[model samples]
Target: MPATSTNTCRNNAVTKVLELEGLTKSYGAVQALRGVSLHANEGEVLAICGDNGAGKSTLIKVISGAHAQTSGTLRLNGREVRWSSPHDALVHGVATIYQDLALAPQLSVWQNVFVGAEIRKTLFPGFSILDKKRMRAGAAEYLARLNQNIDDVERPVADFSGGQRQAIAIARALLWNASIVIMDEPTAALGVKETAKVLALIRHLKDTGVTVLLISHNMDDVVQVADRVVILKAGRVAAQGALEGISPATLAQTVMTGEWPQVQ
Candidate 1:
């Protein structure tokens, strides 16, 4: 049987990668999130689900360092942490891939992958140029690690499919050596095959010991990939548990009604 939601470091096999306690956020009079607490073990695919206005987006923003929480704490690998910015979060091994995937449509795949942290080739002292060759090879290597094949890393992102774009974004995260990846609606609006491709990429991340915080409304995708799920409602955690025996329909209903299905 799969394990339920619990803090790790109890066993070598279950070291936790992230933890939250009394996490709260507000926009002056608007409480976007309440004392939301959760933990994710290393390599675990933890699905975060909630209806519109359930604080899923706000919670992600806080976790990804886009916004600071009003109160409470965040811990990575059992060490308390506070993020100053999204780049700060990325530097600390947390990377967020939003619904847009944040790719430069006009840029080539390698360019998109190494957007912020570009490799530099020094021709002389105190001066360097973009190391296109190294970055291109590295980008291809990362995508290959995800089992995605792109014939040309120089091709503009605008020419690729939605799923392939996702791969490129993930490869960017890989470039950062991210330990935790937050994916927002990764398979949204994708064709079945494309969705499968994205899901496979997610699975590959998990298999490689990367903790994933997956925000998705598709219960089928959640059930197929998530080991555990947290359902939020009205800025608080409504229900949470392992997905061991639950069906996607039941999970969907739980998300809507804020109640876990009762055991017979």
Candidate 2:
């Protein structure tokens, strides 16, 4: 088990976009989360780090509405909110981009971006058609927001690189006007170039005033993009603090030992 440290980070004067208080989840015989509490301030990148079985996935599942917590309160923008499903959470301005990107390989760029929430135009009183023109244009705009230039919006997603696929997933979040974006292992497997591109996309999201909850195992990646970090250990918050003076080596050490003596 890793050592525990106090939670000493502050949000300054920024607003808390998402707050989880005493959040817990349990199975018939196992408790996955034990009173986990954390907050993500508006327009900031908050990194979540932990070893395997540290409850990172469960925490993301609860926040992304894939599963409901056994007991806890979730506040979005200072108001209590509960999600019935992932789409429910998405429509309420929270979107999660998983490690796989959740993109259809056969679908085109615009189609993938507008997968669940496709735009349509009513041609008659009772009939509507897919609005490809508007959707394509909108998708292009979203991609542009991430500094990506995909000349063909009709290109298949499978043809793009790993980082480009991430951009497509993020564009979908932008289409929904998500106030908070949760990215899970955004840079898990990629070359140096692709990882850098993904990092740039995260910075772009923060620049656009979008709160990002980044869950990653790569300490260097986390250290580069995270404004603050929360380290979990065995279904509990072992430690959390700002990453201002923490190096990648220091952060990795803290994750392994759950101690941040000098970084604090």
Candidate 3:
């Protein structure tokens, strides 16, 4: 059965925030993804793990509106719709934080947080001014809420560490009221302490009732922060289940060999 056919592994009581059924994507002669399906519950951390060529990036692109699926159905909050672009997905409350982060290096923290979606106040008809004061304050509040160590919101993001930059990106997503946050390789290239901080931030998002879709190769991080996991092999789901019942070794084995072993 397809992964989306049944929400058996999911908590039936909670509503599914995002659902993809038989999602397939192809690039000319190259078929990047097959008939992949999955669902993410509201306020839960769902991890997607796979080997190097398992089409993980293609799947993420499909869901984030970076690429349209060749054949499949994507349902958001039980409604069927197609997003034209990443901005459309963001408008629908689906925010993706890619590895590059897309932050303007020279811009201040507050500026980066509210880059395209700037807050504004209208003083006259057809005229509005950017609410710099409110944006700065809001940015500071969001960062503080996440318990990040960035003391100054007016400083350029280029001056911050990798983990601090990740925290800011997350804050921007939450500031936009994103119901579902998709993070791709959030811990990549970071030191041990930095990775821990990002993991804690993910936990914080879950605690605040935000659904998170985490894509990472770090089995230890997945085991530590993910509530559930879906392993992909050759562009299809190989195994999926709650992390509490599966060990990190089992997850690693499933990714490497495309087999789900008995947990005992």
TM-score of each: 0.94, 0.93, 0.92
- Could you tell me which 10 consecutive residues in candidate 3 have the lowest summed lDDT? 1-10
lDDT of each: 0.90, 0.88, 0.86
Candidate 3 per-residue lDDT over residues 59-165, each given as its tens digit: 88888889999999999989987889988887777889999998999999999988777889999999999999988888888788789757789999999999999
Best TM-score among the predictions, by candidate number: 1
Question: Candidate 2: lDDT over CA atoms?
Answer: 0.88
- Report how far residue 58 has shifted in candidate 1, in Å: 0.3
Our model 2 lands, by Cα RMSD against the true structure, at 7.0
lDDT of 3: 0.86
RMSD for each of the candidates: 5.2, 7.0, 5.7
Q: Name the regions of candidate 1 deviating beyond 4 angstroms.
A: 1-12
Report the C-alpha displacement of residue 111, candidate 2, in angstroms: 0.6
Looking at model 2, the pairs that clash are none
Clashing pairs in 1: none
Weakest 10 consecutive residues, lDDT, candidate 2?
1-10
